[model samples]
Target: MNKKLSPAALTIATVVIGTLGLASVPAAATRPGRAAAVHVAAHFDLASGQTPENGVLEPDGSLDVTFSVARQVARVDPDGGTHILATMPLPADGGANTPILHFAPTMGIVRADDGTLYFLYATGTADLTGVWRLRPRQTPERIAALPADGLPNGMALDRRTGKLYIADSVLGTVWTVPVTGGTPTAWTSAPELAYSAIAGANGLKIHNNALWVSDTDDGTILRIPLLPGNRPGQLQVRATGLTSVDDFTFTGRGDEILAALNHPNTIVRIRPDGHRTTVLNAADGLQNPTSIEVRGTTVYVLNAAYVTAEDPNVLVAGLRDLR
Candidate 1:
């Protein structure tokens, strides 16, 4: 959830941005030898204040994004046009305060094979906070309600089982609910998943027969072995030293992972051998990049530009030849 910026939070964020010198340098400057062929698939002007947090690439190649500040979900066409899909309705009692920041509405989103979209959003009310589904030409329907303290974020689906996995940034817990609609149960929880001062479990992915999750505050990516019967086995650290990691996806090779590291404003490729490579950075025109999705050999990055008060853009880079 993108919390409403309070005076103190704004001041702190400003200090952090200034300390990093991020406010002074433009995003277009390329780091020598680190440049990848990048293009702006879509650009959202600052006037719109559309802080796109997370998104999924659709079957037809369009990208669907969650505008945190705008409280709406929109589809970004292949040519970069944006079409609003749904505006979240406010809760009857005025949604409950978000866990920490109390910022914006939608957080995590995923699309099923049949064009059904499932998203996790803040309703400002405990009872209303949960997963909601939207099928084409159909009204939005609430499917599950998480605990009052749950601040749900990244999501993944097990296509074979028809189960959806959700990550709670605040409580450091992962919950699973059937796509057909049912109660959500805690799939797993640990000290590593809980939020410290910043955030906890942010992005989730099921790859290579295991569940991979990034612990933002702890700067670690954990791989939990998925056993039979939808049970989770041991939790092992796959990679570390990733500060403020957000959404991530498996590369075409399947042996490596691409992640959006928000704080340092870079996208990194983590190999199974624990080697990390900088694929793109602030120099490559990334601004507080929040999530990443790959279609074939093309990589799409959503830049929230959260630190800067202006001009957030989406960047697309081709990796077919590079790979």
Candidate 2:
């Protein structure tokens, strides 16, 4: 979901989603001293509504991705081949009631060690809006129901606790539910997570015994400690001035992270001290980059092209800093 603009403005912007445009790599993207050689690992068919919104990378180098507009989940291999895993049915109302996007879209995904996939689906209807699970070879099923009035954008699974945390972009709420699927609980609702004009609480990750959330509207990242008995501690602002950050992942090097700035078409490395560095940008074939996944020194970025309406692709690059 490339959502830097308000719901009203984004709806108007979709009028141009069908128009394609050529992109020129910025001079900074290819300037001297930039060490990463970013390349497209997979290219999606935008015409088929294949906008890769978010994904999780598997150990075998395969990417499990959600096709936002098509309401489908797919596995993209290293060789650029795609295999459809599951497809959510179209809502009867054509998704007109969907909170922000106004279209039933699938977002956020996490893969379990057992090859089970858990993802979010929001259709503005109680019947289909919630957390869904796909087992190895079974049909996708809704295990937990979320508020249809909210938009679940990003999620993280805490394997140690058997819990899943979901971020609601519209209601500005963080929800927690069991991995086995049941009713969801409103884990927290702080002011920093409230949406201003656009959205808040856009991305989420469980790292270092804490839950880190990104507020797209406020351009800030917050950390909430996971206390004993799963209680949430005081909120702490970790980083600021990060507008348009949709989803992020920790670099596994302390508190450092790589975040996707959707509107800017850039990905940045944010240090624990609030320092930021532009890691990749338009020159690196980014078209509204949405989410990031890091495995060792390799970084995978998913481009939704929701704003650019151009090439929706998955870009892979080596992070020299991580090396």
Candidate 3:
């Protein structure tokens, strides 16, 4: 689940933005590696709880998104059509027992090649808090139960290894579960992943035989190598000073990253050497940007508007010279 920014986080965001020296500039203005054009691809109903938290791009150009507060998973078509796939049931106690955020939230979501969709749901109860599986034409079911006190924030599926990696923000631990669904094991619990004030490990992705995670409270990106026998090697810090980063994606280049700085309301490209460049900002229709997806020369950004509480939408931008 996403969190409201505290005073300390706001202070850090100011420092980070000032350090980048990129403010609300014109969308067409040229920067080192900024997007050439940005436009709203879809607008969601914030009042109705259609805020997009995380998303996955479908092969046919559809976007599968999890509506966090709505506790629903829906697909947004290229033509701006929304089709509800599954809606998680409301908790019996009306989510009073929900961990951290105090409401049942459907967070990260990923689609398998076989057309099955897997997502994370945290309701602060043993029975309802866990990873969920939604097969085509079938109702959603809980496949793995996570700790009730922990909030599973981000998730990634390793196609090569058939394993799913989950980031428990409250617990500050990374868990590994088989795609077929069973017991979830604690893959790694590091100090770097623990929360200092806000959320801990917020976003996760597997790239180049390594697992990449974002620490929301720490404002850093971490990398863990996938060793032989599906074991984790060492944890390494990839980038820092990225305040309020939620989810990120690689630019198809070696190790360059485009991350969503949620509270900062900007998208930055972090290089392998830790140098950062602001690519998109509030001028590009960003409202608490949560996650991003890149395909070919286009970038899809999700703006949840959780804090802004206005104009929740998805922005599409052109990667002018990112190649």
The number of the candidate with the highest TM-score is 2
Model 1 ranges with Cα > 4 A deviation: 1-27, 30-36, 92-96, 320-323
* Candidate 1 lDDT, 1-323, residue by residue in tens: 12354342354356446544555434457556544577677887444546788999888889998876566788999998998898887656444366664543687999999999998887556666789898988878889888766688899988888999999988899999999988998999978888876678989888888888988888888998889999988999988989778888888786588989987888999888889988788877787788999888888999876675444678888865333
lDDT of 3 by residue, 1-323 (tens): 23444332233345434544645323222344344467788988775677798999999999999988778999999987888899999889767677657678899999899989999999988889999999988999999999999999999999998899999999999999998899999999999999766689999999988999999888999999999988898999999988878999998888999999987789999989999999788766788899999998889999877655557788888876433
Q: Quote each prediction's TM-score.
A: 0.89, 0.90, 0.89
lDDT of each candidate versus the true structure: 0.79, 0.83, 0.84
Query: Which 10 consecutive positions of candidate 3 have the poorest summed lDDT?
Result: 24-33
Which residue pairs in candidate 3 have backbone atoms (N, alpha carbon, C) closer than 3 angstroms, thus clashing?
Answer: none
Clashes of 1: 11
Stretch of 10 with least lDDT, candidate 1: 1-10
**Candidate 3 residue-pair clash tally:** 0
- Which pairs of residues collide in candidate 2? none
Between candidates 2 and 3, the TM-score winner? 2
- lDDT digits (tens) for residues 29-130 of candidate 2: 443454346778888877667788889988899999998887999999989999999999988997889986788888999999999999999999999999
Ranking by TM-score: 2, 1, 3
Residue-pair clashes per candidate, as listed? 11, 0, 0
Mind sharing the TM-score for model 2?
0.90
Candidate 3 wrongly placed segments (more than 4 Å): 1-36, 321-323
